[model samples]
Target: MDRRALPDDDTVATALALALRAPSRGNSQPWRWQITPNSMHLYLDRSRSRPVIAGEERDVLLGCGAVLHHLSVAFAALGWATIVHRMPNPDDDDHLAAVTAVPRRPTNQDIAMSAAITRRRSDRRLYSDWTAPPGYLGLLTERAAALGAMIRLLRDRSGGSRAFEPRPTTQGWAADSAFGSPGPYDLENAAAYWTTSTHSEHAPAGSAAADEIAEPDHADLLLLATPNDDRLAHLRAGEAMSAVLLTATNIGLATCPLSAPLDSADQRLRLRHDALDDTAHPQVILRVGQAPDATDLPPLTPRRSLAEILSPVHA
Candidate 1:
C-alpha cells in the first residue's frame, strides 16, 4: 500500500466525524478512536459505557462495531480499501478493532452506502400501515449474511406477534406492565407510555394522543442474531446491523433498532427459545417498514464531536 494513498489527518478526522453518527443505545456513544498516520484504532470507552442498560458491554461493543463498519464504508467512498482486524489486542480487552485504509477504486455500492450512512436514523416514530415490498426482507437478510450475521424476519402471521409478549411473572408489575396483568399489548403500551413521558414537553397541546399510536400492523420485526454469544459475535452483529440499516435507508425504508426487549438475561433466553427457537442468539431487534406519507421525520440524534471521540497516537 502506498503511504501517499492513506488519508491525511484532516480527511481521517472527517471520516471519524461521520462514523460517530452510528447509532448507540440511549445515545451513550461509548467509543474512542486513536489515529496514527496509516491506520485507526477503535476502543471501547469504558467511561461512557452504560452498565445499567448494557450489561457486560454487549451493546457497547455492538455500537463500536457499527462505527467500525461506518468508517470502512466512509473510506471506501473516498477511494480507499479498509482491512479490519477484530479484537486485535487480546491483552487489552478495551481494544475492539484496528482498521488500515489503502487506496482502491471505489465501487458504486461503496458510494451509495456511504451516502446512506447520513440518511439512516433510528426513527422510533410509528411506521405507516404500508407493508414492505415483496423480497425486500430477503435482500436485508442477504446483506447481513455477507457480513457474518443472520437476520430473521418475524411477521404477524408467523407467530412473530407473540414473540414480544411479556413473560408471565410471579411478582410485581408482571415484569413488563406498570400495573395489571401483562399481555401482548403490555410491551406496546409501555413503549407508548415512555415515549409520551419523554417527549411530552416538545409535544403540542392535545397532541399527546399522537404518541399513542400502536406498533404498526404492517411493519415486520427483524431479529439480528449470531451463532455464538460472545464479544466477537456481538461485534459482527453490530457490523451487520450497520449494513442492514444503511441498506434500508438507501432503499427508502423506515427503521428503528430496538435493544430494550433483549437487555435482560431472561428476555434474551425467552427470545432465543420462544422467538428464534434456539436457532441463534438474538442481539437486537429492528422494527422496519415504510414511513407515513407527508409526515415530518424526527431530527437526527445528537452525536459527540470528533474531538471528543478521537485522540492522536504517538508512534
Candidate 2:
C-alpha cells in the first residue's frame, strides 16, 4: 500500500463515521473533523461542550481523544495507519488532534478492535455476578499502558475488588460548582446521572442502583490514569480508554465508562489519595464484568449524521 495514496471520498467518510461513534459525555458528540487528501483534523466543537460537567474542558478533550483513537482504528482496518499529532496547533485551541493516514496492511488485531467498535455498548445495567477471568484485567491494563496511560485496579477497604458504587447522597453536587446555571450540557449530564444512579419504579427493567450490586466483591473497577495532567495526557487517556473498551467488547465483557467521580476537584483529589494512593492522576473509571444473560442488551445510542460533523479542509 502506498503511504501517500489518497483514500476516496467515501472511504474518508466511512472512517470518520466510525470515529464519531466514540462515546462522549452525555453523548454530546463534542467534536468536528476536517478531511483532506492526506490528513484528518480533529477539532473540538465548543458549542457542544458541556460547561456544567466539563467546565475545564477536561471531559471535552478526553472525548476528542477517544474520537482520535477511533479514527486511527477505523483507518487501520481499512488498510491505512494513522500517525496522530495531538494538540498540534497552539493558535487553535479547538484543534485537538491531527491524524495523518498512511496506507498499510491491516493487522488482525486492528481488524478485531475495529469490528468491536460497533459491538461495544456502554452498559449501565447491572452486570452478572460472574467475576472477570484472572488475566482479563491485566490485558486491559496492558492495552492502556501501550497508549501512554496507566490502569489501576481499585480495591475495597477490606482489600476486595470493588466496582461501580452509587452516587453518595452527601457528596456535594451543585449546578454551579464549576459552571453556573443549567444549560443543555448540564441537563444532559444530570439526566444521565439520575437515570443510572437511581433505582426507582420508573427505572428501566434491568436497571439497578450502581451500589446495589449483589456481589460488589466480584465487580472489577479499573482507573485510567496518566503520569501528568494536561491536554495531551487527557487525550492519550481517552485513546487508551477506547482501546480498553473495544478490547473488552471483543472479549465478550460488558463495560461502562464512569466520569462523574472525576468531574470535581475535590472528588478527584480524594480518588487520587484513596484509590490511587496519590500516585498518578486518574482520568476515568471503568466498570467491567459479565453482563447478565437473562436481560437483553440495549440498542446502540443514536449518533449525529456525517453531514452535521464533517467538512472539507480549508486552504
Candidate 3:
C-alpha cells in the first residue's frame, strides 16, 4: 500500500476522508481537508466552533490537531511522504496547518496506525479485567512523550479504582464533570453537529449501584499533560493525543479520552501532585483496554461537506 502505486486523485481523496474521521471534542468534526495534486491541506473551520467546553479554542485546535496526525499516518501507509507545517499563521487563527504529501516507503508504524483506523471507536462501556502486556504500556508513554505530552497509565487493581473519580458535590456538579469530560461523546451534541440522523438512540439510566458494580478494567489510563499550559501547548498536545489514540486503535485496543477531571482544578489536583499550573495542564486523559466484545461503533462519523468547510478566501 504505497502512495506512488496509487497516484490516482480518488485514492488520495479517500485516504484523506478516512483521516478526517478522527474523533473530536463534542464530535464537532472541526476539521477540513483540501486535496491538491501535490498536497493535502487540513484546516480548522472556526465557524463551527463549540462555545461552551472549548471556550478558549484550545479544544477546537486540539481536535483538528488530532486529525492532522491521523492524516499523516493514513497517507504514509498509502506510501505518501507526509510533511506537516503546523500553525502556519499567528494572525489567521483558523488556519491550523498544511500537510504536504510525498511518496515514500511506508514504515511498520505507519501500517499499524493506518490499519487501526477501521477498528478505533470511543467505547463508554466498562472494560474486562484484562491487562495490557507490560512493554506495550511503556511504549504508549514514550509515544506521548515524543509529542510534548505525558501519559499517566492507571494501574490495574480490583475495582479498577484508579479510573477517573467524579466529584461528590451536588448532583449537577457531578453530572457536569461526567458529561463534560472529553471521553464521552453524547448523542445530543452529535445530532446538532451533523445535519441529519435517523433517530436518537437511548439507553437505560444507570443507578449509583450499577455504576459502582461496573468497574472499569481498562488496560491503562493515560493523561495527556504538557510542559507549558498555554494555547500553543494545548494544540500540540491535541495533535499528539490523536497519534496515541490512532496508534492504539491500529494495535487492537479500545480507547476513551476523558477531559473532565483535567478541566477541574480540584479533580486535577487530586490526580496530579501539583495543581494546574506551569508544570502540567491536563488536555486529555485516556482510558485504553480490550473491549468486552468487538464494537460495532460506526467506522467513521460524518463530516461537513468539503465545500462548507473550505473557503474561497483560502483558495
Candidate 4:
C-alpha cells in the first residue's frame, strides 16, 4: 500500500463500510461521515437517533463513539495508523470526532480487533450462567481504560429491577491521560470545568439506598461508567463499549447492551443512589457471559449501506 498523509476516498470508504457494523441502540446506526481534503469527520445524524421520550438521544453519542473506534480499527487493519481528534469542534455538538489516517504497517493486535468486528453480534438471548474469569475481566477493563473510560462489574443480575449492586471492580480511570488528551472537554482542571449535573464521583456513600442489593443470577453485567456525564463522556463510553465488546467477542464471549433499563429517569436515579454510590454516571449496562455454544452465535443484524452513512455530497 502506498503511504499517504491521509487515506484517499476508496480507502476511507472501505473502512467506513466495516465501521457500519459497530453496535448501536437497536442497530439504529445513528451516525454520519464526511471525508474532507485532509481528514475524515464524524457527525451524529440526529434524524436517525430514535429518541425515546424527548429529543437528542444520549445513546447516539455511544453509537457514534463505537463507529469512531470501529473506523480506527479498520484503518489499522488496512495498514494505516489513525490519530483521532475527538470533539474537534466545541461550537458544534454534532461534530463528534475527526480522524486522520496515516499510512503504516498494521500490528497483530490491530488485525485481531478488526476481525472481531465482523464476528461480534448483540446476543439478546440468555447468557450462560458462568462467572467470567478474573483474567478476562481485567482485559475488558484495560480495553476501556485505553480509550479514556472505565468499567465496573455489577452484581450479577438474575432479572430484578432493583438497584445494581457493585461487584467491586479493579478498574480506575487514568485521569492524567483522559484530561491530558486534546480537543474539547478537557478534564485536567476537572474541579473548575466539570459539575455533577448527571452522576457524580463525590456523592455521599454508605447511604441506606446503597446497601440494598438483590441476590445474584445467571447474568454477568458490567456498567460502562464515566467520570463525567456529558455528551463527550457518553461518546467516550460508547467507544469503550465497542472496545470491550470486541475484546469479549475475540475471546469467545457474548454481549448484550442493556441501555433500556437506564432509559427511565427513575431507574437511572435509583442506580446512582443505590448501586454506584453516585460515584460515576452509568452510560450503559452490558451483559457479558458465555453463549451456550460458540458455534451457535446469533446471526448478523442488518446495516445501512455505505451510501446511507457517508456524506451525501460525496459518491
- Per residue, candidate 4 scores C-alpha lDDT tens digits across 1-315 of 654457777887888889999988756788988877678899999888775458546677888899999999999999999998989998998988988877799989899999999998877544556756769988999999898777777645344334564221111112313433211111101111111111123222442212221212255667778878888888999889999999998888877776654656766776776767888778777777777677987788888998777785464
lDDT on C-alpha atoms for all candidate structures: 0.72, 0.72, 0.61, 0.71
Listed per model in order, the count of residue pairs whose N, CA or C atoms clash below 3 Å is 0, 0, 5, 0
Clashing pairs in 3: 3-78, 3-79, 81-102, 116-250, 182-259
Colliding pairs, model 1: none
Superposed by TM-score, candidate 3 places the C-alpha of residue 41 at a distance from the truth, in angstroms, of 3.3
Candidate 1 residue-wise lDDT, 198-247, digit = tens = 22333334443334433433456788898989999988988999999999
Q: Which ten residues in a row have the lowest lDDT in candidate 2?
A: 179-188
Q: Judged by lDDT against the true structure, how good is candidate 3? A: 0.61
**Tens digit of per-residue lDDT, candidate 3, span 1-315:** 344423577667667666766777677777766655555566777666674444666667777777777777788888887677776778866667866766799989778888887677766555666656667767777778888888764434233434344333343244544443222332113211000010011111363322333344544556677887676787788778887887677667777766544444565566555323346766766767777776555345566654665544345
RMSD per candidate (Å) reads: 6.0, 5.5, 7.0, 12.1
**Candidate 3, superposed: residue stretches over 4 Å from native:** 1-8, 35-39, 154-168, 171-219, 269-278, 295-300, 305-308, 313-315
Candidate 4: global Cα-lDDT? 0.71
What tens-digit string does per-residue lDDT give for candidate 2 at 1-315? 645544778888888889888988878889988876667788889988874453587787778888889988998999988888888999988888877766899999999999989888777655556746668878998999999998877632232544333343333334323442211121114433322223232233443333343333233667889988988888898899999999898888877787765666876787777766787788887777777652477578888999899866667
Predicted structure 2: lDDT = 0.72
